[model samples]
Target: MSKLGESLRALRTRGFTPVAARSAARSFKGVLACKKGEISVKLTIYDWNFLSYPHIQVLERQDFLPELMPHVDVAGNLCYFAPGSVTLDRYNPATAILQCLDQATAILDRISLDPHYRVEDIQNEFPAHWEYGQLSLPWQVLLGEIKPNTIKASYFILEIGDKKQALISNTPGEATRLAGALGANFKPSHFQCWILRTKSLPAVPQKMPTTIKELFDWIKIWDHDLYGKVQNILSQRDYLKQSYMPFAIETPVGWLGFGFDLDRIRREAYSRDPKKYRQYLHMKGGSQGLFRMAIKEVSARFVHSRNLSYEDLQNKRVTVVGCGAIGSFVAQALVRLGAGTGERGILKIIDSDKLGPENLGRHALGFPSLFRHKTEALQEELLRQFPHGKIIGIASSAFEYKQLFDADLIIDATGEEAVSELLNGLRLARSSEVPVLHIWIRGNGEAVQALWTDSTGGACYRCLTIPDPNHHRKERFELLKNAPVLRTDGCRAFTPYAVSSPLHASALAIDMICSWLQGSPSPKFRTRSVEGADLYKLRNHDPSKLKSCPACDPT
Candidate 1:
């Protein structure tokens, strides 16, 4: 089952009723699909209040549930309209209409199967998302569901010029009390009409208003009900009434705030139970840590799953040739994305050069690590970030390296002709079955070439690029060193004028890695660049295949 499906089933296993679970799952699925690049009907949020980015982020983390609260102003600013506040402007017709349509659909779906189903009280769940001033007087299905004995109403505060109007009906005395509770600023003149519904009305009932005070009284009742529901949900979940410490060092980025006391959490977790503490740090956002404290938190829920485990890299050895710009980025991604709670795989780094300022724009090495040899610098950085992994560094040229054939996978980032020739020669010499990913970061930095070879009938570099046949007979060593380079013909320099190309290259390389992991479509073998745009070949393209090509010809 898909992760989402599994999660839905888990929810069902929890206390949620089948109807509630399925209902929530359907809505959550719609939201999840949207997040995963699916398109849907554009939702126009009305003149309701808006939440802060951090709060919105929390919603995103919690799975995008609909919220009910104050409406957003027309300017998209969240408005906390005071009680008994008056406004002649109505909800924006477009957004309010859309919301009503959606609510209507959900209501119909609820009742279509069971005609007797009651529209439960519509609780104002979260803050609103409406534009205030721009929207005119328009009405919407204020509340959705119904339950026995009572019907919930949506209250709207109308503002007109300097005067305010409160619309809703309950009783005159109660309305007067509500207006008085709003403070001295509340004026009777600012008040307008109201809508009141009794038990005798149909579900699609009509609104009957007898007086302004009654409407104001009904508004107060509905507002209080909405607030109660919100509190109920929060209380049920035992969510910390306050947000997580903004400066909590638990999050990777939390260090940006008041500075997290990582040592504190570390010490706390360790002193109690060492193994669990280690798992706490690696469980993602400290879920295990929470469990240690006996707190039922849900921050790091999905980060410790098997699908995300380093199954591909576990117990497998890989060599990353050339600790340069492209090489460092690829290595970092692999380390972070592949390493599990306790890393075990070995990642070997081979490069002879040291870090230089000229390479800073592209290289992952920091300014502090300048002048350090590439292999040593990369190894240190990797070890520092991923203390659990084993990183090996070889500070020597490819040809001089003796252990070239021992690795399981060889990733070639060395943009030198000698390295490629050495790999090809090593494969031929040892009859090595190691798969090689020969990656070439184009000079323009807009694209990268990955020549994947399994040497077991899968495509090899020789099949893609033809080496001169005649030169292999006599001065093979000399010809290999002087072979035609990739930089000469298709090479384009990434001038300082166009620096964004490196970023593009980084993203493409990461995408390739993800695609490879997902077993989806891989990138083209050789991608051509035009004015910095990348294009790839779908099928194998053999430009140098002769009727009797020596290397790839069938025996």
Candidate 2:
């Protein structure tokens, strides 16, 4: 006989009668009767390599008294071993089956006496198996974060068609009207809502009564105002017709909706005394009752956001210097990418220049921001779009800021050689390590370059410029050395690059910054540009450590 067959015969001898066996399926079904209760067990070998660690399920008497146990699901499958905790001898199938049967027998004995006995014995891992329904929201509604004690009135937009649905909105009247205009199949109802924000998402029952009385009793834990308002609203609708009550609630993760029916609940209440039911609906106290009810199941739909994972970027602190054309666009892109919002992270912008008419062509801010400091204008523009974002604009030169040393990452977009050199020095002198990125445009916006320096010894900004045999220092790029500088009125010489040129540079810089934040190994430098009449193009440069460098290696 096979080892598994011998094990089954041994189990039958021990009072575990085999009722059915499927040899092809590698499964055995049996029942064991004890003084406590009868438990029908099924053992199946899911993986031959791990034959000793077979999957065990209790077909009958699957649910214990309370039904909250780790390694066990509502369907009664017993996860005999915690995930990755299986230690069994693959060759000894008989001994493994006997051990599993012994454990299952002990579990049944304890559950028959007290279902919570095992839970009380093993406090850990119960939460992992806790029964709770989840509610998801599109965007994290502020209402969900509010305290329950805070008295506030909110509204919901119900989209009830083939399926019942709802969305939290600040503008209730407008949302209802808009839903009607969209030709939704169901009649819209104006709802007065209050959020019950809990540590865990509220547990919803599988079935809830659809009646005003039930809802009244459900929310009676709140103030009399809520109970009285709901009563008045439901009284206006047909007493006999089926009506749905749409309400909004807040959880730690997101918002939730409850679309309850009134007609069914009213029918259930017909057997009770009218006077008692009225008094029951008006009963008022503290939030204890509501808290208790929230622990159970409720009818809710989860509306999760597609961009929920992007919220992780809020943990990064980024500082951008020189809020000019490239800097402004980079700062805005970081905010849109979900930086500096959730945690202690922030996006600090430093610039001493003002938004003049000349900057309107390539700057992120428009004519409305003229005369405002570049940092302040960009900060305001970003806040208008992302109200919850953390942005600080400092109207000062990058050299004057002492807090740059504490930032997680720093980007220098001043396009000034002097400022880049100063920042490189400041970074090397700091006790705390901070990565620096130097971004600038070449002559006539023909090409742009971004040089990233790591905390460890690497190429600094000055490494890009080395003295030649004639003792004249020149940039590593050939185009920057030969391209003619555009001269304005007096000594005002600038590069005549179009607005599109800086935008391309901004995109390249932002890409490098994001990659670095995501833990990519920093490269020496990256450059990009389009082919033009002057054949102005800069290749990606990989510079070696300069022996006579001042920032990185000083004698």
> Which structure among the candidates has the greatest TM-score?
2
- Runs in model 2 with CA error above 4 Å? 1-256, 261-312, 469-471, 477-481, 533-542
Q: What is the C-alpha lDDT of each candidate?
A: 0.42, 0.60
Index of the highest-lDDT prediction = 2
For each of the candidates, the C-alpha root-mean-square deviation to the true structure, in angstroms, is 23.1, 14.2
Tens-digit lDDT string for candidate 1 (1-555): 354354345433422222223322232212213322321222222223322110011122121222221232332222222333423223232233333334423432332333233222211211111112223322221111111232222222434456554323223333343334333133332222111222221121112112223322333354555324322322321222122111111111111001011345444434534444334333453321110011111111122222464234544577878888767777776666543222345778888888987788777788988999988988887766654456888988866888876776777777555577568656755778876667665544544455555555544455554446564433211212222224322354333313344444445555555555566324435443435243332333323332332445534
lDDT by residue (tens digit), candidate 2, 1-555? 487677667666655555344464467677655456667877766565563467778777634333444455666677665556656665776676777777767666765676456544333332233222122212211122223364334334344566444334334443443345444443443544434443433232222223444455544543355556545544443322333334444444344444443335653464244333334334421111221112211111111113343233565788999899889988887776666665576889999989988788887889889998998888887866665567999999878887876687888988888999988887777634888888888767877788888666667788877757775666555554455468684666666778877788788887786676566635658877666536445566556768787677786
